[model samples]
Target chain A: MPGNPAVPVAGNRFCIVGGASLVGSATAGELLDHGAAEVVLFDNFAFGSDAAIAHLKDHPRLRLVRGDVMRMANLLRATEGMAGVLQLAAYMTLSMDRDPWGGLDVNIRGVQNALEACRANKVQKVVFASSNAVYGYGPGVSGDLVEGTPFHSVGAPPAAILYGASKIIGEQLCRDAFRKWGQDYVILRYSTVYGERQHYRAANALYIIETYDAVRRGEAPKVFGDGSETKHFVYVGDLARANRMAFESQATDVAVNTSGPAPITTLELVRLVTELAGGGPEPIFVGNEPGKVRLTSGGAFRIAHEEAFRAIGWTPEVDMKEGLRRLIAWRESNEGRAAA
Target chain B: MPGNPAVPVAGNRFCIVGGASLVGSATAGELLDHGAAEVVLFDNFAFGSDAAIAHLKDHPRLRLVRGDVMRMANLLRATEGMAGVLQLAAYMTLSMDRDPWGGLDVNIRGVQNALEACRANKVQKVVFASSNAVYGYGPGVSGDLVEGTPFHSVGAPPAAILYGASKIIGEQLCRDAFRKWGQDYVILRYSTVYGERQHYRAANALYIIETYDAVRRGEAPKVFGDGSETKHFVYVGDLARANRMAFESQATDVAVNTSGPAPITTLELVRLVTELAGGGPEPIFVGNEPGKVRLTSGGAFRIAHEEAFRAIGWTPEVDMKEGLRRLIAWRESNEGRAAA
Candidate 1:
């Protein structure tokens, strides 16, 4: 609390680790628009893509650096002279299910390497991107999920639990750094992100794209279960603003949820997507996919974001309907289609 | 279920990774006593000490192999020709708090290397020594803690969370191996272990030793809080048998709790230790240790071991009173003093 924890965006250099993805690119743009002196996009491009970041690749203030978080040397080089560091590199449940070894390396060790580099270079503040997956998936995961919710993994798959536990570890690693070296940091637990520049990665967000694709192909969108399942998502742009605010604000050594304006049922989500894609046939109810990692909660749950308002003076601005409109419009655009 | 999952003890070879400490030495003795063809004690002696295994060092059937779990070649060579491998190498909360780098490498990477070696060496069965710490610590941790209990980590120290998360990862890694290949394994989520050959390492069990030592020096045993915090612990010998039966059973791709007959409050535990050590002054109520990683629960919680009985056909036989008696008697002996 003593040495001015807030590192303002204007006239300051910031680095976005894993900076080619949806949240990363949007956050890079947000920082740049706020008159940041320089914004370094550091990524190994393992999961990041050129098309996702192509729009700002040539921006004057944005510089792209190819680096892997697995290597300390790469991070040490990438974080040099950075006022703030945004750690957005991680493997979601689907990717973790496929390759846990690489996922663990990136999610666990990658965060460690990034934080170590930040500490070594004396970065003023770090904004770590965690997830609601830390609440875990299973029967015990229901009701209002606050920052104090314990992880529930009774019937969840191994990869999902691994992803959640890895995030928990990452958050704790930041806490450890704070206790050890007084490193100022804020952990933003982003829910499933959607909207412009949406990737085909996250298991939860796949419903929107899959539904839109099915509707566009003149087919009925598939709705698994009765679709009463809850899905909380924060718009990528909203999360971008949260990242910028996290650094610009005086909040440090705290974690809070940055969910969207509200939560929506799966049925509502699918219908919203279909309507946004210019109306389609009625949905077809289906059972669970045999091998895919799908997160199922016990009942209706809301990941409240009021803490974000108090902690970082930020609140989500986009609702599902408005967010879906932007997403469908982006999908129809030239860049979004090419990126897809 | 298509093939025999059980790897019987008689006339079988086994490797105990980290088999130089309290549980490791006891387990080695258990396996040898049951007519194992050969037992390899593989350890780097980082946490494993010479005195812990001094009693069994002269046994011809028990071979002491100096190695590190971080080294794949070491694990591979040590596990070769073994029918089963018991992975017991890990850093507890205390050690994890001290050196998180070495701890994370050992806990995460060490387990990975051991499992990889088991797969490479064609080890028939693996009995992974998980802990009740997987249920985690804090306000959310109370009531009956069963095998499927979700992890509760609110208000817990960073090291404790890291330790618990690492074990969760370890258990999931075993499940992942089982799904990827047919790696038959049983994960025994052992609670705070105490009995003969008890080390001064574990946070919870430290009270027992500290109490006994205090009694020996004519001082009062110190108790934290109102001394009603619940502590469920498994006797080491019973855990040793549980490990043996875990390999010898048909259980595979399963995890269960291996707690004691019941839980004891801090005051009761201190009183029991005092009585067992031939009576002493009343326990001194003390405040929480400032920088210590003492695991205090929200309320009294009992880690149920019913699932372990169903999975491995084993249950806690030695009650805490009896287990502490043996521990106190050992403390009065030459071997225990030398080990201490």
Candidate 2:
């Protein structure tokens, strides 16, 4: 708290934990493009696919470290001499439903290990990748979801609640580290992220890819329920910029939403995806999937990102149309289809 | 879901994980009095004390098993042949703040281990001791904290949020087990407990013991803030009975609050404790103790236990005054002083 908390990108070294996936790869490129001296991508390649980071593998300034967050030595060694660490390793709801033990271990203890490594190595700042899932799911989740919104889990599935609570615990672990050891940090509560390098693991963002695939196959895109449920998302590039801004800003010990400019309904999203994918038949409405873990909200809500501007002077630059268009183009590309 | 979910105590066997403590001892006695064939008390005694369960040690129906919840083998062996298992092994906010590494392991993974053990053993019912902290802290938490109340963490200390979120994860693990393996469970969201065998570890319940100690030393009891902060507590005996009722009822995969008849403000609670501990000086208003973990609520709230009545035909019979009177009586007795 005594001196400036911001770490300049140029000539500085950074490490991205779980940096082989969608947001991680984007943020790594953003940091590298900004003249970072060295950018290390630490991943165990468990959920992280090699195809996701193939573009960056040959970059001279980028180094990929094969490591697991559950192991302290991996984090300690990878984080040594780093100026900042972007902790992005986690299991979203789908993977959590399949394996909660591994998810909780990575989400909770993984964050703890990352922070401890930062402390041990004297890393200047940590920009932790949190999620708007911290606001939780259910009827109680509606309206503007600011950083202070309580987690609502009344009717949410177990895996969804587990994922949200684990994120909440992860954020608090950062706060605990800050209070206990003055480990500077900024928590970015990202909404569903979409765009180039979009992954299929996220429950909400999967709708985009699934709808695109259906449209490509000349099948009608499917929308669950009335399709009036709100879905807020940020472009991966915008999130990448936000992660960079978090390190460049003087913000520390704060958490803020980093959502897109506005919200979209499921119906609108499907229609948009259909149109963007060239052409498609009329969409069909369907009931909930029987055994699939789906995240449902009681009412429409928007994850506000004004606090991100105030805390780190960052804002979403990509609209849904533009972001989804990028995602479609990527899906048509060899790299994206290979990842798919 | 096929057979009777209820496991009657008269001819059944039970295991209490983290059993050598306040609620554990009280619930152990309740089961024995109800004619349980055998009751196993499993504990690591890390935070649990020997004096806490001394009175129940010699009972012919009770047996103590030294074990750690972290070790799956310990839980697997202890939970074998058990009809019902009450998981009370956890770190409150104070202990969580001290050692989060251990706390997360015990609270999150420990619950997973217990549920896994129960599933492997084909245990009929699991009574998980979740806390009203799942409702969370800060201003968003106020008025009628029913079973569905969302968790609010704005302006709360990190330790408190971590503790609350850990409990949320624990409950979801129970739900996850029920969904995955048909593991029958009843999650009781207990409020702060105060009665004959009270402990000093809980942030809110420690108020009673601290006030009693101050009054006993002829010093004015201390009240933090304006002392209007609400504190809702269930009697330890009532919780014990609720545990029994939970197992005896046919309810499965249900969570309900188990609070007292009502809530009391800090000032009223301090004064009541002072009165119960013989005549004492006027209570002193003081600011929060620096560097100490204190759970401060944003506004007045009551943890409604009405759902418990509906779910398991259980209701709190003890109010603040009576619960405090029993605590006072115990404090003056030989066993309580010896533990103190």
Candidate 3:
């Protein structure tokens, strides 16, 4: 084991696995801003798009590598001289419902591949991007969700359960790697992430974009199930800081929740998005759409990030209103329009 | 979709994935005894042993096909014309701890491959061998463990959590196949299985065998903790019956527990094993063995099988005492001795 688990950012090289992503891009920028020698963005563009990282394309200290997490050679080469690695490559519930085969492959095997590569490359520390989905869905998922909360899957969609269980397996893989080899690592169980570069792939986070789009097109935003379902989402920028803090902290072999400042119900979120989208029509209440994979909680719940503050000296700084405002502003911007 | 999901065992063909092991061999025998025209035992023998299936090697109705679940071609060829496929291929906590890469491949990808092969072959029904591990291990795992119980993994070992989460994914994969292709399937969430042909692979079940071996050599059986941790185990013969019923019944798209009549604490189990082995020295109480993987459940719990009876009209017939007696008899027999 190293004398200290912390891997200082200054003058150190960092590799972001699945780097061409909302969180990945933001973390790369954060690392580069902190005086990192080089920030390598490795992604295969499977779900990633060039537009997501277009702003960082010209940075002298930033480099993009076209790579796939399923391919170990790419990861091995990417992390050869890196001091830290942030694994953000995974498939959310929406895509998992469409293609479970690929989702399981990328989510489970992908993490193992990245960890093995980091071990072989002697990467100083790894910051794995886990999800609060580890707590799971349905009736059993209510109340304050701490890091020790059990996974609840009763009444949940198979795809949603698969996605959650896959994340659980990924986190365990990191823990297993640490036990076998003295690998210093921290797992940030990020809640739904929504921000400037947010994609329409995550089941929970997609609701914000959809509500905004409906309001933008002069239609009432739709809220399912009386809009009482709780959703907690972290801004991409806050998560980016969490990733950087994980690398700089002495915490190792630990996992904690990294959620937004607070959770909002569907009705509240729809109302907030409609107001932010230039005072649109009243929100419409609706039942679940058949054939749609939706994640629902039985009761109101909050994913507490107190453990995160203790683990990496970090906490979510962006509130939903501010985060949503930034997201809407980005949607109207040229870069976001081009990406859409 | 079939008008009726039931697939009669009489005069029909069946394939058992991972069929050279304990549950596989026993289920194959049960199917053959029920007048099935042919029974195919497909396995790679990586964990499966020839001794486990030695008794049925000469049976004209039983055909052993050497195959690996990781290979789709092997599964496709083995599952051809099969009315039902029993997917038993998996790596338990011990093996998963040793090699997580191989374990994840066999547990997750292996289940997907079997389901896909069943789809391609137009198989009538599938009986997936899921485990009670889906409920997970930890302090939160107490009381009656029914089908709807959520998974608890807060304080468990990484390998244990990995094994449980893998089973959860496997069960969801079966559910996904059913929804996508109208595949008829029944999931049997078996607790620890022990019986005549018991193997030394399962973490919980190995305790019984280990205790017996120690007692036989005049050594005191070792009990970790106060020996009050609950362990619920189903007899292999009873599980075989459940597998056969799952195929013969009309139940599909449902998962239920198949456990013994009741649960027994660790100390009670050790005492029973010692008595079953013709009385031995008192068990020695000790702390956890260093460098060893141990699955510790927090509170007393019983895995309920009422749902299994409701779903498949099956319940465990042999209690642990009777089951242990049969296992002891087999161990002293010529066949069991040679196999060991």
Candidate 4:
């Protein structure tokens, strides 16, 4: 049923680095579903979920290799004979801010290692997973966050955060690699992606998942900010499809913004999850935020997605309402399986 | 003589990475002449000439260490307790074009290793040896170069040429190190530098020095490119002084052009060398026919060196005519010593 002419026919090998993570796993699934002959998942298990890896274990076309990207030998070995590489292995966002050394080692050095391997292996294309955090809260609407925007994150609040700076540096690495190697590459700057398999301990996606779980358990869903801040919450499945589209598109110089078309306010998202969970409990809004506050909401993050759609002839099939329902259902099924 | 009211009166310690090379050795001498308390020369002798290292071995305040910058342990050991670092150790212009792997490994990875050492050692100032070759031959004026011109370089040139791209990448590395670590760094984008102790076999400087030697031996000097091509030649001593000034400057943002005040036409330069060599031979100007012409001779590679001069009170006292005469004398003396 996933027959699409744009999707490369089966027997074409595709390798997804960091394939055991939320995005990586979904990308792997999409590639296999679209008839890739074989999908090799390369990951070091740093932040990748075991369940995601286990779910794909039974797929005939999927193979898993546990490896770190920092080691060039390992990446080269895994990338040998691969047709294309989707580099998704990277340090966690929170990890970047806390452990800058690890972040640089993994993000910058690791990415270079991957590129070197790809170049050596004669890989046809490389798709890098970048982030919207590189935007660092556009300067009013006029900033309009274009690809060519001279990144002025020098004194920005996010620049002070190591995670955002790593993303910026990663983008620079991609640009340099393109300039130097002329390799067909695409940078997917994903927004706040959330869905099943997201770690409940992580900040962005965990907040929503834990809040819904708490409300269902007859506890209040706690909110950090004034409940007025907003962000674009893209479903992980949709992000995976976007990556697939990018791989299929012939566009060489592409850095598509992958996010939900509709920007959902944090408070509204919480309320919708609570409603979907059958009016479990009221959300306890903790007024006044502590950490960095970037209300990068509304239609601002949607611009790149529009560009992505026009370029690849693709769109997100799952809306927030249905996406949330699917997440809640997955959570319930997992809970039931645990109880049994 | 090297007193600067800008740099505090306390003696300054400097670490010169790859300090055994022509540029590094020259820079070391300049620093010593300007009154640096101590200078440490770090190199693995990868491409550094042994004679250059031996020449400075007797200096009272200078020390030498055999170590590669690619090894983090070696870099850390070499840089420990230094107040300033002058990084000049790199694969030469012709070498980079031949072995790109070695070029990337040494130029990019080697730079990172040095920077990591600098951060660990708490080195106060970093003066990176960059090149104007990064600008690739500009239009109109042969030497009318500026700091803001766009970079252009095709793969390795006639001689395996990773030097240009490596310098460009090196500049990026410095920028990243500054942004991430807040370490003060100055990128010295140098033009064709020549003086005593420089090897006579290298391409650019070799042509000039060989011409001088041939004239001294009563042989005709050959000129390529119609005698119209020009080059900006800074005396090695002046470049060394610039390094000192860069180290002493308090400004964090620093990337300045450093070249001789006068642009030397290839033909006129040969004539001056002929006269300096006691008028042994006239130069034969070959017309502007090109097989592999490095036609960067005319116009202004001269930048606002006044910025550096004001900052550190550095003045190039060695004029080209006197400098060439001195170079010929040094070469003759060295040959005599070798024969003895």
Task: Tell me the whole-model lDDT of each prediction, alpha carbons only.
Answer: 0.92, 0.93, 0.93, 0.69
The sequence of per-residue lDDT tens digits that candidate 3 reaches over residues A1-340 is: 4547899999999999889889989999999999999999999999988888999999999999998999989899999999999999998898899999999999999999999999999998999999999999999998999998999999999999999999999999889888888888999999999999888888888888888888989998898988888999999999999999999998999999999999999999998998888789998889889989888889999999999999899999999999999998999999888877
Chain A only: list TM-scores of all candidates. 0.98, 0.98, 0.98, 0.88
TM-score of model number 3, chain B: 0.99
Tens digits of per-residue lDDT, candidate 4, A1-340, equal 1212133536678888888888988888888898888899998887776776667888888888889998888889999987778988777555554554566567657777888898898777788898766554433222244444322232333222335444544554565566566667778888778776665434567667777878878998877555655566788899988888877876665676777767666788889989999997777877645563333332333434667777666677777888888877877886424421
Candidate 1 residue B193 Cα shift, in angstroms, is 0.8
Residue A100's C-alpha lDDT in candidate 2? 97
Model 4 CA deviation exceeding 4 Å by range = A1-9, A71-73, A76-82, A97-102, A112-124, A132-142, A156-185, A200-233, A251-255, A262-303, A317-340, B1-10, B20-27, B44-58, B87-112, B115-340
Candidate 2 per-residue lDDT, tens place, A1-340, comes to 3457899999999999999999999999999999999999999999898888999999999999999999999999999999999999999999999999999999999999999999999999999999999999999999999888899998899999999999999999999998998999999999999988888889999888999998999998899999998999899999999999999999999999999999999999999998888888999999988988788898789999999999999999999999999888988899877877
What DockQ do you compute for every candidate structure?
0.82, 0.95, 0.94, 0.06
Would you estimate the TM-scores of all the predictions?
A: 0.99, 0.98, 0.99, 0.64
Off by over 4 Å in 2: none
Fnat: each model in turn:
0.72, 1.00, 0.98, 0.00
List, residue by residue over B1-340, the lDDT tens digit for candidate 4.
2222134213778889888877788878878877888889998877776787677899999988888887899989888888888888777655544444466567767887888898999887788888766565433223345565433322223222235545655665676677667777888888777877767435678777778767766788999866756676778888887887777776444566777777777788888888877787667866544434243423444544554555455656677887787777777786424521
- What C-alpha lDDT does candidate 2 achieve relative to the native structure? 0.93
Model 4, C-alpha of B219: deviation from truth (Å): 21
lDDT of 3 by residue, B154-181 (tens): 8899999999999999999989988998
**Candidate 1 lDDT, tens digit per residue, A174-231?**
9999998999999999999998988899998888999999999999999888999999
